[model samples]
Target: MKSGINAIIWEDSANKDYGMQNTGLKSPERTRPHHIAVLAYQGLCLFEFATVMEVLGNRPDASATAWYHLDVCSLEGAQVRATGGALVEATGGREALLSADSIIVPGWRLGPVPQEITSALLEAHAGGTRIASVCTGAFVLAAAGLLDGRRATTHWKYAGTLADAAPAATIEPGVLYIDEGNVVTSAGSVAGIDMLLHLMRRDHGVEASNKVARMMVAPPQREGGQAQFIEHTRPLKAAPAIGAVLDAIRRDPAGEHSVSEMALKAHMSTRTFFRRFKAATGHTPLEWILLERLRLAKDMLEYTDLTIDRIAFEAGFGAGDTFRHHFRRIVGASPIAYRRSFQTV
Candidate 1:
């Protein structure tokens, strides 16, 4: 939603089951269901932990024969206290990690991670298990030395702390998540849903991922590069003229909006306008305009039956080829493919 896209409606696939053969997409050869181990500890963050469950665990639409084999492994014990004093019963222990194809660490409690947990994670990674962290769970992966020299992300509020804690890792606070081959790290809270959906896309395909996301009533694909929900640091006394320019651009993204024209409309020189615009909106004028146009184009793609050429022109991209290029580059999918994945009608 922060990316300005609406939730996608599920298109009923020909194959109601989990197999991808009917979708014309080949899934990775798997004789058995993939094993996913979710780590549970005391004072666990319930929402992040549940996101992994909801995404990868069994559901009405997911057949047990084809869905992932999810095990809640307790780091503390069989019984662990989650947030708000809720108790969770884990199905397995740390030994589950070694056999899992993927391991998910939900948000971690602040402070030192237990040596045993870190040791287990290290062994799991060493055995070719892909590891992922949601929110503060990144601290655990950092402690395990899994994030060293890799690009990772966490809640923007904790980005500085994580940077200090794992100096060897590159911390990107703006994006929703980062997938570094075998290591994946996501931002705080609900961003974990996005990251998990991305994993579903990688494991299954766009159709299968879209099916799962539809069940959750979420967007099928929000680009990982999409910024986190961080408020802009706009000053209260910021120039009203810059605001007017921004409003005008948003109102008519299809209109010709050159830098000189915007500067003139804002009653300032180009240099002064550029400074004021960035301070107020946290983006350059061009960047903001491009984002607005893309947002509009995405809405059209999902909610309307507009042709690609017409939508491209309406969104100010001028030509379908240019629109397709930018859409794939920024949204990580072609406009047509995005339409197929998200079109509500």
Candidate 2:
């Protein structure tokens, strides 16, 4: 699985010629062909918007694929200028959205979102269309009120703004993305590529998405969440009562660790330690440790073929079963399943 030959592939003889002449073939007509519409908001990120076009628009023809039909829709038949002063022209406006099987909002520049775009997003969501956003575009989705009470992420730099705008939402500052089924949000800039490719995989299965990734020279997958890249800016002068304990945990996750001992080390009362841990990590002590352990387990799984038992111990889990449980809970897949799917190959 560590080799490059592990790519997943799928092909159908029926769609070999790429045309849907068989009107009676219900599956081909009703399902397979996805109509994707991308909202070309003003001040678009050239790379992010082009990422969608490259993957979905340049799909191979001559074979009957029921491939994607993509439309870049701007407002009122007007050409919206992109960031860095590039002009973008859409074939149509909201009409493209009304007909789309799904809609994507690519990253936008930081500013107030236009009301017209927000209203259309609400209408589409209410109508059962799947909606997603990339980077600052998540701001647009949030502005439309689609992210209320849902877990979402935007660029870490702007996560505070997103949370403030939609207090009903839970803000995950250092994550690649989060999928609340119909509504999904992604983190900063290029992470949008990961979210869109993932949507392709979820809707059309691995093979189709992989093909698109291959064509675009994008990685088929990038796992272990955006937290792996999150910097641990723990202070070095561990003098603060609670700060010392948190820093120690980072250095030795395999060591025996508990709040009582942590409080003792920090020379603080247990109750104070509990309150401060939450303030420090934006989560409970156990929640933070669990994520850290699972993150360690994922690294071992990716880099070595060590058995789950060994990984469990190295990751500081009480047992292999416990490690599997938390890994799946946090990462959304079993360790074995994740390895099979994402291990270098």
Candidate 3:
């Protein structure tokens, strides 16, 4: 990643403060509960819509004094059709969006957003209501002109379409989510859970977010990025020899498997191995190894009380500084911060 991108990622990971301070919104006061309005529309994405309710709507515990107040709003009167032939009744109307501290737009149908919805979102955003989208819900935000000039993402399948639809926005389909201060966008389906968990972490605290993750039976933090979930041009099965090599690396990522050694093991020249590896995995051999090592390191960080140097050695990074550098560059957070955010104990 470029230094600028890395800086943006780092700020998002490190800064727990929410809202657009530059845009004149006061930082959330923890003593007072925050209000979140989830927009329900015709042909609603049941899964993505439910994710917002499950993550932010649910109260944490009986002892908690302050929690998010969630309202399901709609532009279409009280009744909206959701996926799977279900009808959802709204708790409020577009007016609820105006008073909300945050607004969530779930996966939307790929079509024009109604003028009323667009105007409501624009007015709400201008009032400093933080807005977020899950999956194709980005199209709704894009239509409202919110994502223009912001870094956003969506399902990899629709990334090209989103790019074409909103040329001013930088669509990064490789990451799980992007936190551009007041505007946040997440990738497809389950990635919404991660993005919501991140929002919980920002609004509340790591411990509070971890407690919510535990209640939901989800990971408090995911490793690496969304690149792992994207499909490759060709399956590893197409190159059985390369498959074996990849399997071996997974089994012992700490082992030294240089390009020459891997090529020799696969009974191919180094040049041929590089070409086949890229074709099969959509990443060069070195990039894959680095990602695998980072995954392993993240696991150790979350599950074990290992020191940085120990994790470096166990994850095959050779040195602590090197491990920290790559971890921050690729994972977008320091090892300590990652563990603090994810570790249960």
TM-score of predicted structure 3: 0.64
- The residue-by-residue lDDT of candidate 1 on 142-228, one tens digit each, is 999999999899987899799999999999786677777688888888878878877776676677778888888898755333331
The candidate that achieves the highest TM-score relative to the unseen native structure: 2
lDDT of 2 by residue, 10-106 (tens): 1111112211233231222234467788989677788789877876665555675756778888864568888889999897688667667678888
lDDT (CA) per prediction: 0.79, 0.72, 0.81
Worst 10 residues of 3 by lDDT: 1-10
Cand. 2 TM to true fold: 0.66
CA deviation > 4 Å runs, candidate 1 = 1-26, 59-64, 223-228, 232-345
Clash counts per candidate, in order, are 0, 6, 0
Better of 2 and 3 by lDDT: 3
* Prediction RMSDs, each to the true structure: 9.4, 9.4, 8.2
Give per-residue lDDT, candidate 2, residue 204. Answer: 59
